[model samples]
Target: MSDYCRICLEEDALDNLLIPCNCKGTQKFTHKSCLHRWQETTLNNYLCCPERYDLEQVLTCRLCKTKYNSTSANFSWRLLYTSSPLLALARKHTCVLTFGISSFMCFSFWLFFPILFNVAIFSYVVFWKKGYRFKFIGTNEGIRLRIYKIGLKVNELKSGTILKATNMIRDGMFKNSKILIVKNKEEGAVGFIFNKFIDETENIRCGGPVNQSSVHVLHDNPDVEGCEKITDGIYIGGKLIPRPENTICAIIKGYSAWDSLQLDGEVRSGLWQIDNTECACLW
Candidate 1:
């Protein structure tokens, strides 16, 4: 009236039945209730880790894969820091065009063609800057910008800005290269040219145009150290020249940003451990 269970490594009552599941490279056996609990625990534990590979592995720690509830935690303030400026502006502009346009249009309906020229000129000047917005955003699904004039819908403005050609040059081969606004142009700006070369050799480009010469801004900042300025207007964490056009005030390494986001989620939910194996605590 007894059977052997692989989990407990002991004999149990005859009513117990051992079943094998398709878990690869691992084995376990348990009572009916225990088996179900084991499966749930195994599956939930596997789902908790962040997908980004940049995080270093941690030992002797466990992450619980629980649904993060932003509302329940009173963490609404987190939105202010994470939401991009371009996204906020897009929302504001759409509201103004929808409610504000009705008044402007009805008042002008009778004035008709006489004021049409002036109105057209005014509308063009006001909305022309929107085109620059569509460049960077380029078809993002999470948000959409509505374009309108005189209560008539026009087009959709997309997100993102194009990295323009600059005098900056990167040493070694370039892959996934980007322009980053590491600092303020007035206070100073910083741009980084990440080199994904096999040797992992990163070339630093830091400088800003002062008078006729491009000065190395990172060198002057005193915050960044041990980074060599390869050329003028080249330094680690220097101000971006011309600034991020439109609403893009800055760009960091996209991967790094996503990592920060994951950490933010964990912190908001109170799931982050000071020594969580998966979290490097870069935040």
Candidate 2:
């Protein structure tokens, strides 16, 4: 197939032609010299009356509407000569090249602010001779450390210890529960909701969801044989061989249990409050 130059419109000298843009068919071929001269003319027109033409039109093709390839077509200085004038034009109209003043200011600020920040940081260290001390917060995790220090920690949980649910457990079944620790150890822990009474049984309490089907008992009477004391006034897993004269007892269906370390995690996460030291009432 014979190639024709879009610029010179000649059939001969096809070997000197280069395809530079997305233009197809006959318009695809362009001579290196011819293309450079055409770009120079378009750039001159922009320089003469920039309002009459856009710089993009100088660097791009009108037909294909694509930016002209700037790579050296043939190892000639023609590309260098063509770009020198364009760079001069860019310098002459520096404000216009940036699209306006506000845009230029924004670009400048973002480009230099990070550098200025690093310089200021280094200056502070050099002036004070503190070397490098990067302390975002203290070792105890700042706010959390302050908060948990005022309460009983998860590691402090033990048998008969009382834990009240915080407002953070708003959507769960354990919300607003005052739990009395029944069995607590490394194996796991079991507690019952002391404040939630069951509707089905007159005095039986609803423990919680973890071991929902299991039943346990808590009582204040040591007279009941086989009763094991849990805390100051609490007992578990005993029989009423001889009921005491004054006994406070509850049969709880279901119990709340945690796997090893699970209860500790919950307590630390602010789900339960141990800081409350008021002589609290228990169901």
Candidate 3:
């Protein structure tokens, strides 16, 4: 009546065996490594069941189809750190290439050194940028901006009236909403907005313009329900909403702006008036 790992078929040991899922007796325990390997191999078999999928990696028991509770704990740091599929693929590729090159050319240090150096530089330029620059141009009523990379633009705002636009980039009217504006020594005048803020999880996106450069705002609300993407932008609820139109606002980047000041709480809050009846504001 000894417990054994259902995955590896090995006798249960203290460090190796884990009761990941809610199964009884023989089907209960599995080796962490074995389970992880199986999950990795069969990752393609999982489908997006909106009701059951919490946007996390889940391991289901093959025998009973019950999802394991401890799957999160078993995830490696690489898997946990990658929030999107593209990033996960990048990490996997990097790991595989590094391992393959190191194993095959362990003694050919001089030959591979230049290749490795070029790869590192290429990675830095492609994946990491020197800095983030946002340009906000003033509209008659509000400001428009975009995010730039190496002088090339990536994100642009979707066209729409003020209300139907993505709330990710808010104007002065959205005061009292959880968005903030601040000045940074390095980044200059910047705005901070949250796409999702709950408990320990906080995701910040920013948008801004220069000269008459207003800080385009990027807000994240991860808990928003029933969000659907359309050709113009995203449709959350019944509204045909456009994505944040400005480049600065459309860029899907996250940063921490804990020191930013809330518009309603700041001195500038007096300059604007919120028309609750119309759901827009005048500044």
| CA lDDT of every candidate | 0.33, 0.72, 0.42
lDDT of 2 by residue, 79-130 (tens): 5446766766877898786778778789999999999999998886674453
lDDT digits (tens) for residues 45-135 of candidate 3: 3343324432244445656766666442345533542545764466569978788889778768777888999998887676436433346
TM-score of each: 0.17, 0.43, 0.23
Error of 3 at 224 (Å): 94
lDDT of 2 at 51: 72
Regions of model 3 farther than 4 Å from truth: 44-58, 71-73, 76-283
List per-candidate RMSD values in Å.
Answer: 27.2, 16.4, 24.2
Give lDDT tens digits, candidate 1, residues 248-276: 11122322121112222322333322221
Task: Give the C-alpha miss distance for residue 34 in model 1, angstroms.
Answer: 99
For candidate 1, the TM-score is: 0.17
Of candidate 3, the 10-residue stretch with the lowest lDDT total is 154-163
- List where candidate 1 sits over 4 angstroms from the true fold: 1-116, 125-176, 185-212, 217-283
* Residue 136 displacement (Å), model 2: 38
